[model samples]
Target: MKKARILMVVLFLLGICALLKCTTNTQPPAADGDEKTSRERGEFPDFGAMIPVAQFLKQYPGHKIFKLSQDYPKQLPGEDKIPAFFKMPFDDKSKWMDWLLAARDYCFEGMIDADFVAQDNKKRDWYHMPWLHYGPLASEGFSGLAKEAPISPYQLAPEQKHPGQVYALGFYNDFAGHTLYKMWNTSTDPDPFVTQGPKGGFPEGTVIFKFLYTELDSLDVPYLKNPYTRLAYITPTFKDSTNRIIKTMNLIQMDIMVKDKRADKYGTGWIFGNFCYNGNLNKGKTMKDRVANLVPVGIQFGNDPGYKTNWINPYPVVKTMINDTLKETFINASADLPPQHLGWGGRLDGPVDLNTASCMSCHATGEFPQIAALVPAQAFIGDTLANGSMKYLTQTDAPAWKKYYYNFKCGTAYDPKKATSTDFSLQVSLALEYYWQWKNTLMGGYYSHQYAGIQHMAIRGGIPFKQVKMIKKRGKKQKVDSLTQTQDGF
Candidate 1:
């Protein structure tokens, strides 16, 4: 009897170990230099069933060709190209603009050495984050344009803002790319925090640039004329159809975000910089002219801790409006940049972004199993006031309203009970969301997605989502919504 008890105890421990391994995480056996070596050796694990995207390049050969750079680097840039601006102190307000400009140029040089027009620069390498090519705004074409945010006709500089949508392509540098490879280099685990634990997040020196192009032209927004253009296959709209179409859109904004430890001293450990395209300033047809038209909109290092004012620069801005009170945000007063429609209380926001939320605030909610919505529920649906501004449905003094303004540390969970933070990278959070959506579709789920509350977060940032239909064992057909199941008030 004693011998039998001992054997049973050993078997019980083994079962627990195996169960923990399967439930807690999925580990990939990759070591030093493995990211590059494995790809070169073509030793890739199947990423499961591949979803198809439109192939307009084969149909129309006249447009400017685009190539999706996928060679993410495990190594960081050397001394010649290091981000020197980070070494400079942030207190020097005189040189803040210069530091931001250097950072912007660093991103541009990192992508294309021959300037914006160079598509074949061998030395310069940039990559697109994988797993974004799924669902409604699925990335299509070499440019990988994903249908993004919807712009209100009331939000523009020249008072000619038109209701239209923008498509964006996000490019990651070597350092940022490595984080992606580490997070998604395997099919066994796609969660950002799975391979790299919840504490592990994007390392310093990571930089990501998003190129935003809009369908609106000079007539719709008067400031947009002779804009830099690209032809990509994209699904026109979710409201209309998911069918792909070949279309030309003009560059309207360039948003750059960099990971730096120094920023942790004041706010989040990242700095966001925005640039707007003014075709009037850059009219030459060449790529150089189009790129030169991009003017610095601003740079943000913090969310101005303990500051929450119900102030906003009304849309249809006829002249520049810079709030003198914001200490963490710096907007260029250059006459060249068209009158800015800055975000909540004049914080950093891009042309394609909504005027209601700052760049940092919207991104603060990025976490796995995204329990928190990007904006407060009040900001989602509101009334259009007389000033062409959207009035918050709820009072700005609500507790949730001030939550986004708090200084959040890197890789720290926004809601500690439900999810792990993505180190303020909404792209990473969205990527994981899409991957789960695809996985759930392949092998059904036990939840009702049609009633899911995650729709609010999935609507604008990601590709369009459609209901998934499946037949159960009892022959009962149930329609489930995409994105996520009801996760609120849990």
Candidate 2:
């Protein structure tokens, strides 16, 4: 009897163990060198069923030429060598439109494929590119503008209203990728102010595209039905274990900045363009046709002094949704929208209310330690209001309004002889700011102290500390201030 009881107990225990194993082993085992756990490498419900790039190309024959270019101009003098195919004259509006469409297709190609996985099967989709976010972590924050005000005084802008939910994915062409990698790799390095080395400035043929999306219900406003196509990728944020379909974030805006010496007369050798999605596309029924909905808001090649700054805005009147209500806004449509609630002359904005900044003005603020701030805290007295109300200073010849209007310059409009050039790269300025923030952290402070101690000892032994002048030729040197010096520039 005792032996029988023991055998039965053993059998029961084994059964329990088997049941536990079955329940616990819910996810697939990771392959070797696959540092990502199952949760980190989110499962794709229809893994193999994703639309392949080749198939997509076949379906949309017009996008056949949208492939990565092997040879692109990288430096000065080489700018002139850029092929006619890549160069669109400022006056040629049709050519610019066609080039932009093709460029968008080229950048988004292969975004749906699973083969392009980077960093532990973190699916690299069109929205989640490798070079953009830097890691697997999805951008965090509320879907739209934050309910509360920002903690930093400098962050007091319309764009700063949202902390993280407004996800942005950036892409660099072959010419710019080389430089991007170098800067990104050293992003965590102790020194924060180093903007240049052997590989710093982007090459002449470099092109950067930034796609900005706003989550549904982001603005607590009713969204237009079928405003944009939905993306295949699911949002990692959800209570249910099953994957929920995250609609392709409403395609608010797309920004394109290019480096070409032909634009050197503007000051930064860069041309900036902003495109806003027109939910009411005349011919867009399919996903491919939706690309046509992106109307060119304007292009800033230079911030000329006398003129109101020439630009092209194909659609001046647009239908928009705010706070769940439908509304119509009048844009300059001919020139870039003047500085409104956000972004300069409204060139740097999307559908959302953001900082008062302009594309070229904001980008031109890119510099090490970011000495010069771009956008002023308050709007100009004669500046156009967000509601499309203007004081008509342009017609009155008022000095104050005229002075405010002249501030609109393209990225290349700055005089290098008078001010230091950031080479038309915001990444350079951001890198330095990142370094400063890192050095101020507790761990950063400890590491910095240790390094400083070593340097002090070296100095006693005849080594000298590297010195940099904080002030320019005409002024006294000033102390290095906060790491957040460039926060308001955006």
lDDT of 2: 0.38
Best by lDDT: 1
TM-score against native, each model: 0.78, 0.49
List candidate 2 stretches off by more than 4 Å: 1-84, 91-95, 109-165, 186-200, 216-224, 229-248, 282-292, 308-356, 380-422, 442-490
Number of the top TM-score candidate? 1
- Candidate 2 C-alpha lDDT tens digits along 1-490: 9999999999999999998898778755655444342223331111211235676566545531111111211223345534343655652433555555555555445532322221222322121112111112222211211111111111212323322234444555556654543333332452322223223455667667765654543243222234554343334342122332333555556677776667665444666666665554444666545545566654555433344432221112232211111011112232322222323333334443233335555565454444444332222212333433221212213332233234322222123222333455654443334444445674655433223211100000010011111112212222222211312312
lDDT score for residue 203 of model 2: 62
Q: Clashes in model 1: which pairs? A: 136-464, 137-463, 137-464, 450-481
Write model 1 residue lDDT over 1-490, tens digit each, in one string: 9999999999999999998888666755556555443355443321211124244345555644444455555555664554677786553556677877887777676344444432355555666666666766666654567766766665665555456677888877777777776676654755557312345887777778888988778887766887787766665553443466666788999998888888888758888889999988855567644676889998888888556666655566676668767878889999989888777778888877766577887777787766666655334323446654564433455456677677677787677656777778877877777877777887787335323334334334322111111111212222222112322211
lDDT of 1: 0.65
Prediction RMSDs, each to the true structure:
10.6, 16.2
Misplaced by over 4 Å in model 1 are 1-59, 62-67, 75-81, 110-119, 158-161, 194-198, 283-285, 380-383, 386-388, 391-394, 446-490
